[model samples]
Target: MKDMLIDDFQYTAQELLIRNKSILDLITKYQDSNSRVNRAIIKAVTQCGCMTISAHKQEIPDDASLDEMKTSVESHIEGLLCENCRDAIERDIGRNVFYLASICNALDLNLYDIILKENDRIRMLGKYNLR
Candidate 1:
């Protein structure tokens, strides 16, 4: 597998965000279920202040119902989001996955190897200096 620079990964992430709608559509169609994607979406959305990471941590009033809490989360995500930023975040997630896959293929290693041998992996990653 070919090596990818960190810059390339960053660039790809940006590109993915720019094409956010397309990525969402694909996710809807494919039902792709990966936690990283979910995390990236949350990270991007939170970064844009569409919602706070600690929204759930807020104290709920005794009068508030479960439905209200759910609604609050939805409203936070949908009501205040920056469309451009959200799109970009989705793209960043896709780019990250692509980068990881490329590295795995190049090294003939699996995800377990990368996670378990992170220091070695980082050293290998250091080989591809930024262009």
Candidate 2:
């Protein structure tokens, strides 16, 4: 069977954008139809943050409470991204990822080390924030 690993594919931001041309086209197509599309993008990003946090902690999301998640996510989106700035959103996420990597490096936590530690913690203690 083929390897089901993300490592098999490599892409730059430009390449990724090119691959997702439909999204760009949709943004352009709906640009004049109010700011609903942009708002949706912001909403998706906020939901991503919440899901990532929940996933790290192995917390099963309450299906019945998704409306609450959406509300919290929207609030977070509003606080972090005002005026629906896509460029700012992209830059912030990129910078934050870089900062996290830098911190991990400074702490001598390589990829393997981090995975092992996380596994151990998950088994023994539990999933808490790294900091």
Candidate 3:
């Protein structure tokens, strides 16, 4: 159960990845997918008018606790993604994840093992893991 999704995704990517077998191609495709993900979000904001990002400096107090910082910090993104925007973003993100799995496959790495190791590290480090 633990490795089901990650392993399956990695296997599927390896099988379906016909055009981009080269590591260089995989990395560039990964970068392209990342760009598309960003583009989808930008389109959601600028073209669709479904969401807006209001960038500003975070003003968390110096003495604030971790919990306080978590509460005070804001994403500054307003509104929800419309169905069209949501679908586009999801599709782009899926492509990004696929490329990531393909890269792992090329390197003879197990995506599930990587994810599990990262999870273990985060759990072990807990509050101090972020830095």
Candidate 4:
């Protein structure tokens, strides 16, 4: 089940995190992992030439509803990731998740529970959840 997988990943990450047990270390490791993920995405755009970021300001008319605004906003991503870039991005993202789990382990928090609560909040708020 997907729930089991989430818990299993959190537990496995907690068990495997040896050096970065301290909260400070865990936070730093998490930030570094995040940076790696950004770097991978940047490489996909800059080095690999697989994607382009055509970002611009989103100007929504006052008459537009939240639903309309959501639909009209662009992600700015121009192309799909190539296989190599996808693999690299996935790996970096996995590392980011690992560090996040490690942070939760250090703080005596449950990553699965956190994710569940977040999902619940999103569903409850729906379009009202601006962030």
Candidate 5:
């Protein structure tokens, strides 16, 4: 039963990752564009929560650090998501973290170490997304 539960959680994590990747890809494609359709897509991406018209005027710098971009996008999204959507997104993130922690515990791995390693990898890569 424990194994089955782990498998279920793993599946959920995978599904969430896939969905998140698609959203990130879409965001990447439209984030720097000024096309009307891209603007529409960005608005839709936020589910029309509270994205202000002024938000469309702010442009992400081409030379901004990945962390900067991530922060900007996340802030924008957070501001735009409805209360319920924000809650759901937070819950999903919590679930993913819980699943990862469970797996690390099963393997006797330190979660903090894993986080540091991943942070180093991201720093080396110099590119990351909202997810």
Candidate 6:
């Protein structure tokens, strides 16, 4: 299984999902249907923030007044969600990207390159109505 901490581990998509299955399930169980969709995106941003903090070995001070951790978790995952249902599409996108990246890394594929290429292709051949 690929370790999120390291870049060297090889993990298949199914394997990685199985490892983080609890988080996915938690999102579904705790959040409403709308939130469920965006949960993945929220998780992505959260994971990115967590990874940066971990990399810098930053710690929340005991005297810290604000819940920085909580804020970080909610960044880019609150306002854009469905107003009526509170779904976080950003979080969902992030989660999907993170998962895809891990799997691609395992397969020795370039994540950024693939993303850019696909994005360009989509722009060139837009089909579906955005809303």
lDDT at position 48, candidate 5: 61
Question: Considering lDDT, where higher is better, how would the candidates rank from best to worst?
Answer: 3, 4, 5, 1, 6, 2
Predict model 5's lDDT versus the native: 0.52
What lDDT would each prediction earn against the true structure? 0.51, 0.41, 0.94, 0.92, 0.52, 0.46
Clashing pairs in 2: none
lDDT of 2 by residue, 29-123 (tens): 33433345444455545653321112223333577364454443322222243444555556555544433333344344453455567778777
> Model 4: per-residue lDDT, tens digit, 1-131?
88899889999998898877889998998899899999999999999989999999987878999999998888899999999999999999999999998888888898889999999999999999998
For each candidate in turn, the TM-score is 0.30, 0.27, 0.95, 0.96, 0.38, 0.31
Where's the lowest-lDDT run of ten residues in candidate 4? 14-23
Clashing pairs in 4: none
Candidate 3 lDDT tens digits, 61-120: 999998888889899899999999999999999999999999999999998999889989
RMSD of 6: 16.8
User: What lDDT does model 1 reach?
Assistant: 0.51
* Per-candidate clash tally: 5, 0, 0, 0, 0, 8
Error of 1 at 95 (Å): 1.6
Best by TM-score: 4
- lDDT tens digits, residues 28-88, model 1? 4233435556765676555655655434455556786666654544333345446775676
Model 3: residues with Cα > 4 Å off, grouped in runs: none
Error (Å) of candidate 1 at residue 82 is: 3.4
> Highest lDDT: which candidate?
3
Q: Which stretches of candidate 5 lie over 4 Å from their true place?
A: 1-79, 125-131
What's the lDDT of the predicted structure labeled candidate 6?
A: 0.46
